[model samples]
Target: MTKTKAAFNGKRLFIRLYCPREFKPKCVTSSVPVTRKVSNRASKRIKRLAKPMARPIRVTVRSGKWKKVSYLIKPGFRNKVSKMAGKRKRLLVVRDRIKAKKFAGRKFKGKSRTVFHKHRVVSGKAR
Candidate 1:
């Protein structure tokens, strides 16, 4: 007969599938997927911002036990990754600035001064 079991840890959920008399049939675990939700406008803005970094540059590196091997990455891949990182950072700053503007003059629960200062600097309103 077929048997299935499920378990939930504090952080993740695991499911096991197997047949009777099987010591270790098959196990599957759930992990947080890497994803993000952004508005259409934001997506467009990101595309525009990242256009210049679409291509990546490849670099050679030594590896292996002997440490005398070299690997070549596709051209423009590294640049694209770096550009994406920068774009993400910029988007986060923009989001934070918007939140700060909306909550201006209101006291936040945690440290507000640092947030305000960052928002000021990002928005170019710093004196």
Candidate 2:
């Protein structure tokens, strides 16, 4: 699960860069450039846009060596956010059926991965 709805939308854009990954020589990344500097730039931009929202949004960036795997796992949301105020309503629908479980499984391109995260949005009381 992700902390913000914006991430679900951004995944489509990021997939075009990291999917079907390949290994290149040193000083190369994704056949383009995906360094910490580049990721930091993107995270800053996203955080700026989220400033207008009722709550803060968390934008995470995965850095380090490039791997032959997808940057995003799968989209999942909690039922609580359905009636909550925010943006990106279309992508906020709850996908995880099981409640009280923090581990989710996913199989992408014959590769299995376990995603461990809290689906519920943790925040202070609303104003």
Candidate 3:
């Protein structure tokens, strides 16, 4: 279950290169003098972006991850999240957080994986 979500909403690579010309690498990445530097630059830029976005995606009502996004957080969703949340006050709604925390040593342990961590599960003080 956890593994599936990890792969589903996986991260994406977005890059706008500084390749000043159009006669780019004919086939692929190469040692050609002209394109090598450009390609390397692009690669470096990608690496930089990856590092920042690579942070674990945690789910918390307080967190802004799901800010503008809308999902039908109705009774069914509440029930599912409650059943999952159980006693723990954390949940990994996005998926990667589960992998990052390695399920928090319980193979189910996660950080801020609290389904309703902010509403009623943990306490009225969660807000």
Candidate 4:
């Protein structure tokens, strides 16, 4: 038999926080600590707040396997991918780590560093 559930009497609270990018541009987070009360289930849900973040994000992708990727262009570069790779992909040799991260797709779950960190290699080793 299907179990009945109680009506939720949640009090919606709109909490404000700083943009996370201020500390580290391009960094995103689920949420920051806030004073408002939230349900245990909802707390697990991760969402990027519209507001700015207070600090730079210190993140790293840990994986055993990584693809050897090079910019798909010459020294001058051509396509977006190659262009992103810069001079190394063209004339000079280029080999960068491509770590995967959490897939933004709905059908799959689990983090992969290869895809998510693709730009890092071409863009130059991230600090």
Candidate 5:
């Protein structure tokens, strides 16, 4: 007679069907719902917040020369920073970490070496 066997291979389900002697076995496999692709909405939001302000913000280095650093503002507040600039329309700077902690908790998260502590708007004429 014919017989069927089912087995699970990792995240896939496999089935085998065969007849006793004359017929060749057939195998079928399908992906199982054990795993799923997850989208990180938080990271996406943070990236969107940072993208418009592409140019690095200027900061004073140890030697007294100005250094350019790119940073991401905390999500859900890009518009607020834009609004702060008002008619002046200045570039945005992610505030230094030391000063930012007073405004929000866990304000920044990333594997990048640069860290953002807060957010500020500066006039184009300043730098």
Candidate 6:
């Protein structure tokens, strides 16, 4: 008798936010707050609003229980995986949380930190 485990590959996909280097040079700077005793809140708000954001990146998990599935390099694989991942609401929540966190900090953390916010099964693997 022969025993064989089913072929299984698990991947995790998530979105990342960033600010393009060029955007910084083009972003408008907020005016200096009044030198008076009044609140500087308005200027702070302007500064945040003036911050620029670049298009988000869809990233696959790399080096973990779920390994990075290199679908982007394969023809048509990117679209297939994207469509599958799109149906998972958990990924959207993860994206939104990251967006809110960046907005609060007024900067892009990019891929500096590891986030394990949520997970869902996509196709046959755990994403």
Local distance difference test, each candidate: 0.21, 0.23, 0.22, 0.22, 0.26, 0.26
| Tens digits of lDDT, candidate 3, 55-127 | 3222222211222121223332344433433354443232121112232233323222211111212211111
Clashing residue pairs for model 2: none
In terms of TM-score, how similar is model 6 to the real structure? 0.17
Better model by lDDT, 2 or 5?
5
lDDT of 1 at 62: 19
| Candidate 3 error regions (>4 Å) | 1-72, 88-90, 95-125
Residue pairs of candidate 1 with colliding backbone atoms: 55-76, 56-75, 56-76, 56-77, 57-76
How do these models rank on TM-score, best leading? 5, 3, 6, 4, 2, 1
lDDT string, candidate 4, 1-127, tens digits:
0011111112111121122111222222233211123332343443222111122222332333221211112222223222323344422111111222233322222322211111111332211
lDDT of 6 by residue, 58-113 (tens): 43222212222211113333333344343432221221112212333355444233
State model 6's lDDT. Answer: 0.26
Off by over 4 Å in 2: 1-3, 6-80, 86-109, 116-127
List TM-score per model, in order. Answer: 0.15, 0.16, 0.19, 0.16, 0.24, 0.17
Off by over 4 Å in 6: 1-103, 107-111, 122-127
Candidate 5 lDDT over 23-63, as tens digits, reads: 11211111111111222345664544443222233332232
Candidate 3 colliding pairs, count: 7
lDDT of 1 by residue, 1-127 (tens): 0011122222222221111111112111111111132333466766344222112212221111111111122344333222323222421111111111112334433321111101110111111
Q: At residue 20, give the lDDT of candidate 4.
A: 19
Supply the TM-score for candidate 5. 0.24
How many residue-pair clashes does candidate 6 contain? 0
lDDT of 2 by residue, 1-127 (tens): 2233212232221111121112111112222111111222356665343221121112222222322212331233223233332433232221111111111232223222211122222222211
The true-structure Cα RMSD of candidate 6 reads 18.3
Winner on TM-score between 1 and 4 is: 4
Minimum summed lDDT over a 10-residue window in model 5 is located at 26-35
* C-alpha RMSD for every candidate: 23.2, 16.5, 21.3, 22.8, 28.7, 18.3
